[model samples]
Target: MGRGRGGEREREERKRREEEEREEEEEERREKEERREKEERREREKRERERRGGETGGEEEKRKREREKRRRDRRRGGEEEEREREEERRRDRRRDRRKREEEERQEERRKREREYKRRGERGEREEEREK
Candidate 1:
């Protein structure tokens, strides 16, 4: 109803329109930047492929196969190493068992020698008493 009130409403409407326009412009700028970046990435990849002597479908497949082969070779190498380690452990265990058996044999021989010495002494004492 009053001029002052109308003027205030008009100013608020203008501010709202300006904010919307700013937001739209910012959105357009962001979209353009994204498109440019995507194009640049494509160009870079194309150049790389060209530099590598034109990776056609056959070349790509060959490279893929080579990569797979390398991976298999590496896995095989790891398995071989694991097998070698297992073999070494087994050898150590066998050596320890052999050593223990040898020690037991030596102890048994000593016990037999002690028993023979005691029997010889007893026989000599018996012979002297009979004389």
Candidate 2:
């Protein structure tokens, strides 16, 4: 009976150690799973941040392009306005020159008419003195 009791006690002790070892292994497995989950979450968050930054960079580039286009258009408009003003000034100069020429021509015509009238009057006086 003493030997049987010793054997039974040893069996119970072995069973308890086995159960404790299994519990420890299970706890380690749970810890590993938690670590893996945390790592996966961190990777997902990093990816999201990178994607958001890329989108912001794209938007900034688009805004810069729009501003450059607006500046180019404004420059072109200013050049066109300057050209129009220059053309108008040239037209005004031409009109002034034409008017001056017209006045000179009228003055010459009046002088010629007055000289012809004086010659006619002198010829009439000579004819009356001879008669």
Candidate 3:
């Protein structure tokens, strides 16, 4: 009877220890699942933030392109103005050249008229001397 009681006590102690070990394993599993859940949540939030940032960056890039387009348009307008000014300068130079040629022609004509008058006076004086 004493031996039988001792054996029963030993069995009870072993069972309690097994139960405690199982409880500890269950707690560890719960903790691991909680940690995994938290990590997943953090990753999800990070992805959302990254997506939001990417969207914002795309919008900013679009805005920059628009600004660049406007700048290019303005530069094109300035180039057109410069071309027009160059055309106007060319026209002015042509007009000045024409005016200069007309002035020179008129001066030459005056000199020829003066020379003809002087030659006529010399001829009349020589005819009188010969007579």
CA lDDT, every model vs. true structure: 0.72, 0.71, 0.72
User: Per-residue lDDT tens digits of candidate 1, residues 49-117?
Assistant: 576555455767678757966986897699669757755765675576568658757976896898899
Return the top candidate by TM-score: 1
Q: Ten-residue segment with the worst summed lDDT in candidate 1?
A: 48-57
Clashes of each: 0, 0, 0
RMSD, every candidate, angstroms: 38.2, 53.3, 51.1
Q: After superposition, how far is residue 3 of candidate 3 from its true place, in Å?
A: 99
lDDT tens digits, residue span 10-127, model 2: 5985686576568657656865786697688668857865776677567776787579669868976986697577557656755765675577578668867887889889999999
Lowest lDDT block of 10, candidate 2: 89-98
Q: Which stretches of candidate 1 lie over 4 Å from their true place?
A: 1-57
Write model 3 residue lDDT over 1-131, tens digit each, in one string.
66797678659856865765686576568657866976896698578667766775677766875796698689769866975775576567557656855775797688688889999999999999999
For model 1, which pairs clash? none
Candidate 2 Cα outliers beyond 4 Å, as residue runs:
1-61
